[model samples]
Target: MLKKAILLIVLLNGLSPIWGQKYELKSIIFEGNNEISTSRLKGVTLSKESPMWFLQFLNSFSGLGAEAIYFDSSKILFDLAALEEYYRNYGYFEARFSYRYELDTSNFNANLIYTIIEGERSRFRSTFFYGLEGIPDQTYASLIQDYFNASNDWYNQATLEQNINNTINILLNSGYLNARFDSTIIFRDTSANSADLNIYISKGNRITVDTVIINKKGEGASLVNEELLRKITGIEQGSYYNQEEVKRSQIRLFRTGLFNSVIIIPEQNEVSANNVNLNLDGNIGYMHELSPEIIVNNQQSAFNIGLGANFIKKNFFGEARKLTLSTSFGIQDIFNVDFDNLIKRFSFRDTTLLGYVDARATIEQPFLFGKPIFGTWENYATIRKQKDYNITYYGSKITFEFELPKYTFVNFLSTYYNIEQTKEVYRTNNDSLASKLVSTIGVDLGKSTT
Candidate 1:
């Protein structure tokens, strides 16, 4: 028993060094870590205590299956520096990290070390072009200089591709339809800390118009007016066919209101410069007029009632301006109800009153400003009451109206008045005559549809 007890004491003494040498990573607090957090670093630990913990930690480290020691950090400071570098490789150039460390000999405690460092950033400093012989040099000068000075700008693969596409479009619109640009863009660091770009352009061929054909399809096939067709074509056989002008022609024909639908197509021919065959497909429709209207008014409120009919032409000078001519007749009664009341209150209501009824015939010829202005006018006269108790009055006014800018209208009016007076209402009378001239101005707040 004494021998066994001595052996047991020796064994316990031997095991004391392994158990007492504690290595407890109590906390792995980090600092200077802008992109990564403390929790994430703590999660990377292989051990949290000592003795038996170290054995499990060794096993965990072995299970990492790393081909090299690139991820291992025995010291907290080393781990933070490694983590920062890892973030930099992923384009987090401004990333940093640090740690704190603590040692307690009596309790066997472990603390972390803090570290900080900046990361690597990959950005664009400038963009340029080369091997563009035919294009004007000034075209790219401004764009390249601007992109280079943008320091915070990153390298974008799509932007480079779109730039090439836009360059090709410019060439195509300038009569170089066969132009092409290289797919590859070369990026070089001309300066140690800056990136420079160079793009190559290929100007293939300069083409001109070889021939142009204006074809109209549909019926009244025989009734299709040649004069109108010629005006609509707007392109000659020997002239260069402008793509933009061809599109405008399509819109123009649609606005004419003569066709239900119009389409202009440019077909390429097997010529040196491409020949354009314009195929116009449309349905021709005849012009017609419909006029039916209703109006309501209160005469005491100076209101008028009117109804009319007219004919209209849709396109004037191919600019979608409407031309209209119409004849309208209306009855207007103007009176002041307040005036009658006031006269009654003043004891003048018994005085004899004179009222008039006016009838007129009008002819309107609406036109654009640059055209001649001419219209017809006439008037009729009738008497309702007399003012001098024995006097009866009649009058007529004739006027010619002209239009300017579709908003303002002007007219010249001439009036003739005849009055007859007698001692009694039923007696024969003596007459007097008066004539006057007046100019009138009118504004059309609502545009005339017809």
Candidate 2:
């Protein structure tokens, strides 16, 4: 029994050596057949010794069955082909791999050849639009053409969708309220190796104005009186609303200077036949203005002051216009001294003091790009008394001014003056007429920070 057990142990030990003596990798031959460099492949594998070759060798058996352990030249070629395919999907179509296996008495060495061929870049061929109706054909054509020309180089799903959204906004501002577009996009590949895109849009409806209403508010009363409101409404109760008319009316109301805020809302009147109702609300506030000035000269220093208040009303004659009525008061002081020399000798000296008051009325129209053009006529009479003389001056003047791009200017002006003087025992009267045409051109040097 002892001899039989010893023989069994020896048999089991003899089988262990055969099981442990499986296939061991001698060397790895990397056939680099790719646009990528052979150095890059080496960097990826990074296995210089034979013992480290097993892990990388296993990767060569991915699609093959697990039972196949020994890798031949054909198997290495298959693995390199797989790697080349991986690079092709990433826009590197010209990538290729070639291998050289050098066998020695006891080991093997691998030399890889990677050939890369970069091809022409691909781009989008055409962009198309469809299903857009109820929108102006000219506008649609211009927008799409412009966007295509601007974004020809950039091809992506996100950019295509953004272009559609921008087109929708343009329609909205042009008074198209019911506009929509589908996100579905179709790409057509042609024989020329280019892609064309087709987009579908749905333009729902076009809206128009039918009618408008005006509402007024003030601190203690209505901004526009009931009678004024009645006159300002150019349309009847059932007239079709006009956007141009509404805009004109808003400008007129703003020119009044009485309203601090104005809002125009277009409300749809379902009961009326295709008519839109507009609500205009205005908030009225007081009009306040001030003019103060100071002057210094060799003879005398003087100060002049003025204050004004006014009320504004719009559409006085149902023409969507504004009319303003204003009143103002001003005061001034002038101190003067006179010196005389006769034959190099002092002869006489005189000093005087004067005071005056002025009142006027004016009519004006609002203007764009400059100050408003106004027609003003005034009448003034002043009383003045000096150390040796007493006088009264009266006159009228008409002036017109316009604002220009480069400078503010007085286009035309005319003035008439009459002076009546009295000295102790003598009285004299003089009348004069004068006119002036003034204008100026200059460059504005100020820069805008906003």
Best model per lDDT: 1
lDDT (10s digit) by residue, model 2, range 165-273 = 7777655544454457766554533234344667776655455555456577776134346444433433345443444445545654565554678767777668743
Q: How do the residues 1-450 of candidate 1 rate in per-residue lDDT, one tens digit apiece?
A: 999999999999987874557555555555565655766655554423233445556667686322212112355455655665555433454556655556666665665566655444456655656655655455455334445445447544455555566666556544454567765544544244344566666765444554444444444334455455545545556454445455556655565555667777655555544444556666655443455555556643555555655555444343233344444444443232235554556321223222333333333322224332322233334333333333223333333333223212432222223232222242123333333433334332333322
lDDT for 87 (candidate 2): 51
TM-scores for all candidates: the values are 0.37, 0.38
lDDT of 2: 0.46
Which residues of candidate 2, in runs, are more than 4 Å off? 1-127, 136-145, 148-166, 180-202, 219-252, 272-275, 286-362, 366-450
Once fitted onto the true fold, the runs of candidate 1 whose alpha carbons sit more than 4 angstroms away are 1-169, 178-204, 218-233, 236-241, 289-310, 314-323, 326-450
What lDDT is reached at residue 289 by model 1?
Answer: 43
Top candidate on TM-score is 2
Error of 1 at 339 (Å): 25
